[model samples]
Target: MPEKLPVYRIPDFTPAKALSRGIHVADLQAHRQKHAFVQAPHKHDFYLLLVVRNGQGTHTIDFTLYDVKPGSVFFLTPGQVHAWDLSPETEGTLLFFTPEFYRGNREADALRQFPFFQTWQHPPVFNVQPNSLSPVEQLLHQMQQEYSRAAPFQIDALRAYLELLLIQLARLYPKTTVASEENIWPFQLYQLETLVENHYLEHLPTSFYAHALHLSPKYLNELCKQNLGKTTTDLLQERLILEAKRLLTHSPHLNIAQVAQALGFEDNSYFGRFFKKQAEITPEQFRQKR
Candidate 1:
């Protein structure tokens, strides 16, 4: 087995500090071989997309693992926990950009309107069709050429290409069919979900929200699962783990015990195992490096 590594940020494929402009591009031809180890759950300030050209692997985003095979494509939005488990032989192209790359652009606002940008009970995982891969390949190839352009309009030109790429992917997104109703999709029920996201830290169980929403647990779960693809417990647990990762990676003051208590875990051992089950890394190890 490969030696286990402590949690750490994957080094910038090309050092960010070295770039003079707002964007830089590189073709990560050897990413899979070098990045085979499981990265501790963490988020980034920028956005990235990994296009898998060969091999198969799994990617973890927000506590959900999606199977990735040849021709698969994955997107990482800003500030989402993600890690990859790759075979040593995996090969792909990685695209990275700062938020500025999309800033002040109308398409950026439209792109954010996609449902995948929401807190889905499951991360969006789209299986790439064999035919769709060619456009992605062409986009990457075009992007590589644009990166080396010496023209005065390079930033605007690159942004236009980038917008086109997002538009194509957005078009590919499968639209959810909704049936019209008077109290359609239950707007009030969705308000309850927002309540859960904002205040799950109280460690309130399903009943608590049911009471607040004036609905039975059975009703709430059925409604939430229909729209969000998960039961209330799943959403709560995912949010708890998300916060745990934040505390683990972003905070330096708390040790494992303190962290567990702060997150409402009364038993330290159980908390450790629970975190490992969700994140595939023990809290102590996750906190030590990244």
Candidate 2:
């Protein structure tokens, strides 16, 4: 049997009850003092941000190890498995908030506007130069201070600070070592990814994504080809296959038919054929190996 993955509900930490109010902040040092375990694999019900101001270790997310150093930032979207890799002396700020927090108290903005928030398509780690992180640090410090105090309109203040942090990080994202192809996806591709994120379960066709992005299927294919060396259908299948793999690997109680139904396939036999075509194995076989 596969090891059961640990899934955490909202407010993973003791102080995270504050997260229910919209935003919460904690220091790594305080966390270590409160709990005997410093690092264990876990997933969150909300988004998470960690900025390592002075640290040297590895932060692993979804089986990928990202080097942790001063000015390193980690972004974790909901459902991502992550673990801390730091020492007792390591120091950093951890922030948690839900999607509702983003839409509350202001005009709604798409979380997808930031690169790091798009964790499925992008690496969740960013290595910012120390000299360039002063403003970012100032914003985080203000958020921490506000979260700790009884200031009026506290959620408002936290929201402003969080928005600033996201904007600053988004600006730095394009300058990072992301693959050249990632930078070239174009606005249309960005919209396509957003669409897939929302509607992949519908089992929609490439034309649906093309129409939503207001491009013809040919142009969509062209854009994908130019940026990712893949066609629109290929990209869409990649997203669908990814979700299928997630269900197959994690939802052990679900039978193959249930997995098919959950992913919008009505026919178990059809789903089996589709999975085999894309994954080169039966869903059961894939789950066993994983």
Candidate 3:
């Protein structure tokens, strides 16, 4: 049987009943004091920007452990399971906001361009240098202060500050070695990624995507390889594996075969092999491990 990971639907992001919106920022110590869920593996539906101003700890995100330090900043995406272990003396600031809160009505699709939100590949932790983090911390402090006020255009001010902070953080974020920009997608990798994201459950083939985009399969493959350093097939498989992992670990009611079929895999055995090949563990093992 698969393990049922603890799932948390924060009141701030719940849509059924109207909840207070906009940025929610507070001192980490204070937030911890009010909330008992500090060190539990759970997933939420809002963005979390954690700035560790002091002390040390370990943050477990999606089965990977990251050391937490004073100068580090962590960007956690929605639906990514994570938890934290920190000392009482640890002090910092935490900011949480919904996607609509930050972007307003602007339709902010480009937020994914940031490395941390590239969920398929990059680990969502940023260890900012002590010297370089001064500016970043300053911006976070400003945003926190602005969030406390009933001032007009408050959302505008907060959004502008958030955008600046994300841009600045991206600059300081260490580039990934495996996912380097090889040729810079001058073509349509983003479009291809969007198409895959929407239709990945259909188990569409690379040729189908190429045809939909009106490009030759060879050209699409080349574009994906140059931009993401992976062939089109690998890219699609990565998405499938990620979804399968999510369902397996988070949705324990779905058995192995059911999860495989949901991911558009026709043969359960083939799906298990493919998952183990990419994730280094069989589907059942992964579900139980989590």
TM-score of each model, paired residue for residue: 0.60, 0.78, 0.81
Q: How close is candidate 3 to the true structure, as a TM-score?
A: 0.81
* Stretches of model 2 off by over 4 angstroms after superposition: 1-19, 32-42, 55-57, 84-88, 104-108, 129-132, 174-185
The prediction achieving the highest lDDT against the true structure is 3
Cα displacement (Å) at residue 116, model 2:
2.2
Residue-wise C-alpha lDDT for candidate 2, range 138-230, written one tens digit per residue: 888888888777878888878888888989887777554344653543767667776777888787888898888888989888988876777
**Candidate 3 per-residue lDDT over residues 1-290, each given as its tens digit:** 13466655456332333224556777889888777665677776678888888899899887689999978889887767788999889988887777777667886466667777666556787776677788888998898788666688777888889889888888888865224576443436656766787788887779999998899999988987766678999988887887787788678788899888877778999998999999999999988887
- Candidate 1 global CA lDDT score: 0.67
Which candidate achieves the best TM-score against the true structure? 3
Query: In angstroms, how far off is 108's CA in candidate 3?
Result: 5.2
- How close to the true structure is residue 287 of candidate 2, measured as C-alpha lDDT? 89
User: Order of all candidates by lDDT, from best down to worst?
Assistant: 3, 2, 1
Worst 10 residues of 3 by lDDT: 12-21
lDDT of 1 by residue, 1-290 (tens): 01122333324444444232355555555543454442555566566777777777788876578998886778876656677777767777777666566664554333344334444522455666747777867877787788766677777777877777776665665544222344245553555655666677787889888888888999989988887777888888887887787777655667778878888888999999988998789988887756
Q: How much RMSD separates candidate 3 from the native structure? A: 3.7
Better of 1 and 2 by TM-score: 2
Candidates in order: C-alpha RMSD to true structure: 7.6, 4.1, 3.7
